[model samples]
Target: MIPDPTVRLIGWAVTRTAEAIVDRAADRIATKMKTCIVMTVRHRAVAALPKRGRV
Candidate 1:
């Protein structure tokens, strides 16, 4: 059986690594979402504007 200290050390390392990866991924996803939302809003606003000098 593995020693208690060794197991604790492994668990701690794994937890820290996972947390780091998740944090990085969350930041990237948030950035992309914000960009997409802003672009979509701008596009809709421009499209909704009335046409000028048209029959």
Candidate 2:
């Protein structure tokens, strides 16, 4: 149990820490999603390009 005098500060610290963790996780997920989208587009573009000189 937290003491009354410091409880507010403690709660603030915990909340801030949780928010930071959530923010970092969100950033990582966004980066991975962006990378996946870019890769998919690249693959599609390459596949759509006209092939030449194949016997």
Candidate 3:
């Protein structure tokens, strides 16, 4: 069977495009997770701190 270079190139491009989309989604998810974690930690810390004494 004769291999067609154009078909192979097209397949590679499609695969790379799919991979880029997946990578972007993963990055967004990771960023959201990190933001949530940071917010939760800050809330907990603030809640745990003692009230400031009057001057």
Off by over 4 Å in 2: 1-3
Query: Per-residue lDDT tens digits of candidate 1, residues 18-46?
Result: 99999999999999999999999999999
Spell out the clash pairs found in candidate 1.
none
> Candidate 1 vs candidate 3: which has greater lDDT?
1
lDDT of 1 at 36: 100
What's each prediction's clash count?
0, 0, 0
User: Could you tell me the TM-score of candidate 1?
Assistant: 0.72
lDDT comparing candidate 2 with the true structure:
0.96
Screening candidate 2 with a backbone cut-off below 3 angstroms (N, C-alpha, C), the clashing residue pairs are none
Most lDDT-accurate candidate:
1
Once model 3 is optimally superposed onto the true structure by TM-score, how far is the C-alpha of residue 37 displaced, in angstroms? 0.4
**lDDT-superior candidate, 1 or 2:** 1
Candidate 3 per-residue lDDT, tens place, 1-55, comes to: 5479988998999999999999999999999999999999999999999999899
Q: Cα RMSD to native, each candidate?
A: 2.4, 1.9, 2.6
Clashes of 2: 0
Models 1 onward score TM values of: 0.72, 0.88, 0.86
Candidate 3 — which residues are off by over 4 angstroms? 1-3, 53-55
